[model samples]
Target chain A: MLKIENVTVKSEDKVILENFHLEIQPGEIHALMGQNGAGKSTIAKVLLRDSHYDVQGMISFHNKDLLAMNTTDVAREGMFLVMQNPIEIAGVSNAELLRTALNDRGKNTGNILEFHRELTEYCKRLELPTSFVHRDVNFNMSGGEKKKNELLHLWMLKPNFLILDEIDSGLDVDSLKLVARSLVEYYEAYHPSILVITHQKTLLDILKPQFVHVLKDKHIIKSGDFSLAEQIFQDGFGASTMRNGETNE
Target chain B: MNRIIVEQEEVFLQDESVFFTEIPNSLVLHVKGNVCLALTSIHHMEVYLEKGSHFLLEAFVFMKNQTSKIVFHNEDDVVLDFHLSCLYEGENTLEVNSLVDKERVRNYIRVRSVERFGSLLIKATGEILENTRDAFYLEDIQSLTTHQERVKIIPNLLVSSNEAICNHNATITHVREEELFYLRGLGIEEEKATQLIKDGFLKSILQIEEIKK
Candidate 1:
């Protein structure tokens, strides 16, 4: 369960997000649709406590003050954000990072052999090579491979809450289907809460979020079921949004 | 592929290794064959590579109270790949002079130095003589230091051959904040994350994979 109440985020002297609010219950998947630069990804960054932004108002994750927690603590508290553009870090292998992260969270990975087996299995399921385990994190990888690599981390970390920021972008049709199917399977197994930010109806068609919220003017202006997403797909965000007493006119 | 322990003051190396063997004070070596050489515990050393030989040199340096220099002489068709990893905590100057007067030679030098205290001065020079055709040389150096500890990198490429290719680059940086944020976002603590970044930096700068094998 996560709650955002009248959250205001600012960068330097400029305000990037104002009076933004959303709430997600356990096992609920919410799709946040917005135009370009409508502060959708800003919410994800602010939730992860990216030090660049100045945040105000209240954000509670599992009834704890989320804004007070640092990025590491937020991750330890079962919060994971898959950024639109994953960073490329050279020389730090994926296995090394995953092991360190699990150890820091006080989660034992059983034994070395078991951990290697599990990681290799995940790589196979994701259609990535086993050698990726030793390769640097996201370095020199293709765009589609970077997306799948994030999903690999998702499987490894197994967080309770996920903020998926444009995970479907740069993925082929088959890769998108694979990613969506993986998310559905994860949902069925763990019943984790998810916030998916996207403009693609194909991803929404597969995951089938319970609610759809359109972000505009720095806050959620409309909330509806999957039909709203379908309506936007048929028309556009402008036709679906009611801005300034008009349909986003 | 032969391993050699440097017991004498001078030796001729042809397919022999001196890894984990500290040189006594100083030594002179005539090198041949394709080899991975690690110069250890030597304040001053001289190396002569045979014509048409390939050599890979790796060294992780930590010294105090004295300076160190390694001078290299290259014959025709010789290939030299040098990786120098340095950790400095006191005033030290390390110089690597590669003298080349040969045709169809390649010399690549990479230096990675981290200054935790005091200061470090790295001078890497590649001198190519005239009429040396089809020669190429690269000098890349990266250093990390805080405000109190200073690091200076000097890459000297004195090439007299018009038909030679030469490149020199140097980068000095402190710990980057964005990289730290990325690691911390994955639940790694700040201190450990910093250490990981530094370790990664050191590992990547080596660029000599076959040497480890």
Candidate 2:
């Protein structure tokens, strides 16, 4: 459903990703595991067409070039990226944000009352308080609350391709379980292609990724199965990437 | 001049009622309600209140080519809450007088406070054009009381005025370059970043009033 071919991304006169190529079929959960400054997040940003990077090569979703589309257009084409640090826009309520997203997809507008009712139910399942809907988007919320709020947007919008950027970080045990279960349920229901990026292996254990890619030195050094994540957890990427050597052909 | 005096101990409660008056002299009114008072050429108006008399006074003044003034006087141990807004686009000269002569004189002009449990909002908006010199004088005297006043005056003045409070403070500033760069680093464009700042400012004002209402 998504393809990236020989893409190189540079930011601030430094190479972040070089010749990175990957493809994900529909209903596949691809987990990207790498250490700090390993260009994992940079890959996500590049795919989102972030202007900070001077990008080269092709990134297409359903055969449509992603680099040519604006952020709103990319969003309209069923691509959603949950940021690592979600921005808090003070006066814009969560409900209004969801309404805009739903309306942008040309969904049913007359079912707003039903939509709000369903949102409350979803928030309750996610252990978010009922007042979360009325509060401003992620404004003054706790870390766990912000993660849950992002999950709330995921449940409401239900985009085609979901990019989870280190969403497991800084979450409590209960929140992590809730977020994991929510993703599992969402994948089971809609089966949207998912990309879970993380340095930790705990969430990967729960989500059970199909493919694992190791990003290092501005490129993907190794691509393997979910067992590769456990091997990295046990032996660490330092020895694995050293054995694999600088480049993967 | 028909003068209706509100006695010191009188309590007026009129709900959903309309009052029409052509009174030229000062009308000492102590009214409490969901009421509307339509007055023409009202001069020297004084409204006094007693203790625990919940009142709402809405004075609509229509001064056509005449000098008109409305004065408000608050009594001791009384809560005089007023919301006064005028649309002065005529050639007539109009002046508003607000006086707080007692303790606990809380004035909430243009914006309301969510922290305070019980507060008063005195909001006014006026637009004057075509050689109209309008004066809005707010004299707030407080002793052991708190007053919060916010005023917004939007006038497209063709001619300058020295007699009125014509201190026009106009400012045009672009978004900070650092803020723009920060947003751009997050993949937001320069145009979208500028729009976000403008929308944030406008949305904050509207949100405050929405909470007040």
State which candidate has the highest TM-score. 1
Output the number of the lDDT-best candidate.
Answer: 1
- How much lDDT does each candidate structure score? 0.84, 0.61
User: How well does candidate 1 match the true structure, expressed as C-alpha RMSD?
Assistant: 3.5
- The native-contact fractions of the candidates, in order shown, are 0.66, 0.09
Segments in model 2 whose C-alpha atoms lie over 4 Å from true places? A243-249, B1-213
lDDT of 1 by residue, A76-169 (tens): 8999888898888777899998999899889897698988999999999988999989988888898889999988888998999999999999
Cα displacement (Å) at residue B195, model 1: 2.3
Chain A structural similarity (TM-score) per candidate?
0.96, 0.95
Q: Which ten residues in a row have the lowest lDDT in candidate 1 chain B?
A: B204-213
Global fold similarity of model 2 (TM-score): 0.61
lDDT of 2 by residue, B70-128 (tens): 44454433333343323222233334444443443332222111111112222222222
Against the hidden reference, what TM-scores do the models get? Answer: 0.86, 0.61
Number of clashing pairs per prediction, in order: 0, 0
Per-residue C-alpha lDDT of model 1 across residues B1-213, encoded as one tens digit per residue? 344566687877676555745676687878899877785454788889898788888787777755888898989889988877877667888888988787888988877876655788888899988968898889888887654247777788898889899999988888777777777878889878877776777666654444554
True lDDT of residue A21, candidate 1: 82
What DockQ does each candidate score versus the true complex, computed on alpha carbons?
A: 0.66, 0.10
Residue B14 in model 1: lDDT:
74
